[model samples]
Target chain A: MTERQDCASLLVQHLGWIERVAASLSRRNGLSGDEAEDFASWAKAKLVEDDYAVLRKFRGESALTTYLTVVLTMLYRDYRVAQWGRWRPSAAAKRRGPAAVRLETLVYRDGYRWRQAADLMHSRGETDLSEDELGKLLADLPAGSRGRPRQVGEAAMAAITDGADAEAGVHAAEAEQERQALGTALARAMQGLNDEDRAILRMRFWQGYSVADVARAMRLDQKPLYRRIDRLLSRLRTELEKAGISRERVRVLTDEDAA
Target chain B: MKGRIDDAERLAALLEGRVTDGERAALLAELARSDDGLEILGDAAAVTRELEEEDRAAGVLPIRAPRPGARPRLSARTGALLAAGIAGLLLAPLAWRAGRIPQGSYAMNLSRRVAVAGKGLPPGVGSAPRTSVRGADDGLSPGARAVRLGARQVDLHLARIAGDAAAAGAASRDAARLLHAVAGAGTAAAVYERAAAPAGEAVADRDLEAADANAERLAGTAAVRLGAWCEAARFAATRRDAAFFRDTRREVAELAATRGLPSGAGPALGDLRTVLDGGGPVDWAGLRTRLDVLLGAAGG
Candidate 1:
């Protein structure tokens, strides 16, 4: 057979595989059946474009099915990114790995609940993390935007300025000073940590990842990691104390309401 | 960074389930280090699995079916017994070869033996755990030693199958001695459990059952299926015939379901079982590749 005929025959033989790949991508992205069919058609056209350049690249070192799977997946990623702007996962989620990125996308972008996202991830074989673990790892992320940003009304803006009394302004200034002092002390304390220790603290406190999640990510023992966190906390507290931040002051500054 | 050509090939091999244990391990490690690689792998695996499920539902046969009137092959049991006998015969020569090699050359010889057996040394030799001539050598953890010895066992089996009697025999003796040392140090499973355990917590043999139970809950039924698939793949590797692989695949499908696998493994495991039990000429190569990707995800 001629090369074009050979390529055409090959595509015909594996059309089902191509369709399945397109269907899978569509399902993952929550596209409708029509959209899936569209993707499959587009994929086939792309494959046969340039006189079947994609098929010609196959060296036969790996199975044709595998090569095709990888190729189709790459194409799907490009297709999705082109249709919708790129989905950017949070920095913390990215650091935790691909499963975390998928979870974040499902929860934040797709508006799935923690339970639903975890279930989907499990069902799809995308992750092994439990729902509770997923929640802890993602605790630091802000809630997804439920709606578009709206402008503040003049009445609301007036109320905000009108409510700001001199006494309150004075207290706010004092609080801000205290916050700065606390931040400087904490930054200095953090500087003393090695890279891994710093990462542990960042994941645990800053990113709100669970202790177990932190241990798993760092490949450290959970019990020891707990002790290490405690020890690190104590050392930081001491450094803050040395910087003239009292225990009571530190507690007040670190409280949820204070932020 | 964009994936290199070799990365694509490795990913393809992984998806196809044709990689050896060493190749799987090395590829997994590399994937672990790269988010983009991991993302591509996850997508490919999900798509491949879905396709398999669809194929199973439609009762689609493997692309490469056995030819009509193909010569009947040995049963899986008979092939296994033949493999065992061949392995047994290589032991004497392995022992003789072990005696001939100098003690200091054990590490080099082991790598050479693995290469000779047709499985090359794992990528990044500097990063691979160095196996001393004796297990008593300091600085090597029991878990690390177990892994090294495990690789040796696989290499020896491959060598035996490849008919490299000298390499197989030498590997057999080294494996036996290392296994003995490993037993004295600690059971390999316990060593692995300890390594996985959190720091400052002692993992006694008694606690291993509890640990395993916890792991089962965490990993779910898919992990169990993956483990069974790996075992089946190892067995089928010795018997390259289509019929033997089909039988092995069926047996694994049954074992995966009947073993009281937890529900937490969810629809994914169920889908996989359906695919395995589907009536078709088994695409043994494809099944193996898909299992490799699953196994990698399970942190095997």
Candidate 2:
């Protein structure tokens, strides 16, 4: 095959991971998968366009995996900061300065650190921990944690671009199991949403309305439902993404559009 | 080119405030050529998103937090408009065509115009202040052309309950002016530093609709817990405040639990419990050591 075809084949081979990462990023950032892809593509283009020869000087200074993770993370952080720098910490969170960043922020900043926080609290003998367990551990951390951690997870390391999925597939089953556990916890947290928000969620995810359709059905006008969905999903996705569910992995309810 | 820096600064100021359609047309017409101008627009857009995100995260919602310790955000209508504009700009390079600007750059462009246009206006006749009985003012005219054009562009839904196009347009000007006054770098910032600041005081006193009021209130209450708890943590740093700090932490943690939040809030809240339990140092300096251990413990 020609070089172009080879490249196309490689991209196709890894499309699943791209969607996964795209979804995960979207859920983490209160953005859509499409939005996430815009940044992901930007990263890929930068990768292709930049001369990697610059790294030639640092040959053996650190593991290439560590170095690459840093670069990808830095790029992601730049995009995130650029997109939403004005966000202050949550009232509860802000008061805890140098305290742990939000779970989503923690995931973006230090991928597995929040998870570690969760584990720490669990080990401390807290019993009957519920969905809010994630919150407990981070809060328990010492004040002055200052800023999001930059350390990422195995899943994050695997999904920056096209074809990283196959390599990651070897571990997808394990990751999915983790996501399942988090998903259950997330579902439990759903109880807190107000009725209107719950209704909107039901319409979109359960009733299978297009975002536009949901807007129309609500009769009020505009995409209130979509924004609510995005925000609500961002909260849930924070835990789920950290666990392993890629936003791109959404299960389609039907194949009507395919026909 | 003699006025490049001045013009750029002016344009940046305009972008920072709200731009009327007329102001937008004028600004877009002026800066379409320079690469620097485009960069300014892009940077402003990025800054605005960051600002809004920060706003939302800070609990600037229209909803009340049913439970305390929630973050409120922009109303759904406002959110949709802003989100749509953002999504459009990101997806479509077509939005910014040759010599014509994309309309979505509202925060940067519109906010700036409102500020500049209102700069020296008298109090009652402030820039775009209510077109109260703009009776025929809504009609399209070459003179009122810019305003008319913007009126049409304002999505009817979000503004319908708000007021007519003219009224909403007027409010936009006021809101923009206020926002730019605070966000702007010049004298504008100093003047509106406290006045017209967006932060709300009480959840019930907020302008949120019925659906959102509860969630917003919860978040507001939580904000208090967060602030108090955090302050309690900080003040305990010096010589002997262990019991005081522990009691305060417990208060914070229990508050979180009652709201159905994860319960490391107090008494046994978080890694503090671990540190204290293990007989490790419990001072402020020891906080980091305990936090690090928690951060490192992911069941691996």
Candidate 3:
């Protein structure tokens, strides 16, 4: 087929992914039913418009799904930002800083870690603040920011283009089961975490903040922040391993970039 | 700094391109030793990628324009006039060669031209009565054009079914049955999952079961229609009698009315009839797309 046709076909194949991701994002943000459907449809149209020229520009540095996820997430974020006019952490979350510290701004703009947000507070006279203190400051911001896990089951089904094929069917079912198991394990692991560890991990994975952002937010230097992340991952791995999921398997599943 | 950087901060620094060469090497050595460490880094890498994307996307991408030299918008009246002009141009040569318009060729070409012009005409404007095609005053030796048109329409309908042979066959399979043929099992599963979700208002087991049964019925009906429409279209195409196509159209229109499609059914049905009656050339691409979309959405 010609290049244009190939691109169009590729866009069609990934419509499910676009829908799932859009639905996932919309649901996370509390949009439902028709709202969610509209958001997803709009996202699909964007990807498919101009004969899929958007997808045709892919440089192929990362997995196409990951690229799509990133693109959709950014679009969703931008949409919310536009609608609400620049999200800031709750104005009511009292802090020691002279200027109100929006967790998103701290992490996204200044590349500060969650701990660095505390440092910003500490420098303003909230000295010797505990990690829990920092957690309380950012807790009110949102559930999905800074690496909050998205519910992707329906969205994952969108990736299954050929449900009639036995092999694709098995893979889809297995993937669904795996996702459910991981979700359960993740919940259990989160429960085992102290508030500070939970907040840190949430900022790191769920919010998808850079370590530097989290570090800058929480006011810790990069070194201890990295150690904290490694320790948290180790602890989660240990919890999952105890729950009968192997470390190797966890590694494989977490590698979402693997096709 | 020169040795293995065991500290998480140093590794994070190295990942962010803030580390010296020695610190980078040390982190690489540490990652090779610890698989978990590597996994964490991978997670961090994904995070870094998202951050980069966020930075690059200052705002949503701009909308693009349609390609230059795209087809001009032709209104139905304008299109009819243009088609008439083309038909006149082609017919002029034949008329000139005969020293006058030949009776058979003139009638045949006029019928063809009428069909083309009718495509752009509104349904009420130039549409012949449903039964009129059989006795319409076209100069054709009766039923000849109807037969050819029917045959061509049937070929197109058969091809549409052949294109989806796998999905159509699979509709009878367990997985396909799990979802409706149009929505597939994926949509059915979605409906089931939504119904069964415990966090929402408690839906009764009986209600869930009824919904499932309803979904099954819809899927079954749609699947049957998928096959039935193809077969019917094939029959109408080969029957070669204008009356057959007209009657079949009326039959489906009645079915559509009973189902209460409310808006699209009448127009689409009307459009199909117009094409079948040789009002305009069959837009096979447009027909195939419409059929797939309509059948896919068909629950009733």
How many clashes in each candidate? 7, 53, 39
Cα displacement (Å) at residue B246, model 3: 59
Tens digits of per-residue lDDT for model 1, A1-259 = 4556656766765676677677777666545446578888888899999998886665444555667778887777666666555654544554465666667777766667888888887887767788788888668555563222336578857777567789999999998998899889888887787655666566565544456545433335567777888787777778888999989876653442112
The interface RMSD for candidate 1 is 13.7
lDDT of 2 by residue, A1-259 (tens): 3334333433443333333443333433334335567887775564344343213222222222222323333355457667555332232332232223344344333334656645643464322454376666455433333343446578977877677576688698777886676567556555566544554455444323345433432222344554666687666556555545555542221112111
DockQ for candidate 1, please give it.
Answer: 0.09
Task: Encode model 2's per-residue lDDT on B79-119: one tens digit a residue.
Answer: 78998999888868764462343232211221121111101
Q: Candidates' TM-scores?
A: 0.34, 0.18, 0.24
What is the Cα-based lDDT of residue B49 in candidate 1? 51
Per-candidate RMSD, Å: 22.3, 29.4, 27.7
DockQ of each: 0.09, 0.01, 0.02
Q: Which ten residues in a row have the lowest lDDT in candidate 2 chain B?
A: B115-124
Q: Is candidate 1 or candidate 2 better by TM-score?
A: 1
For model 3 the local lDDT of residue B235 reads: 27
- Alpha carbon lDDT of residue B130, candidate 1? 27
Instruction: Write the residue-wise lDDT of candidate 3 on B198-280 in tens digits.
Output: 33123333333333334434444323332234333432222122322433464555545454232333455555555655653
- Candidate 2 chain A, run of 10 with poorest lDDT: A250-259
Error of 3 at B5 (Å): 26
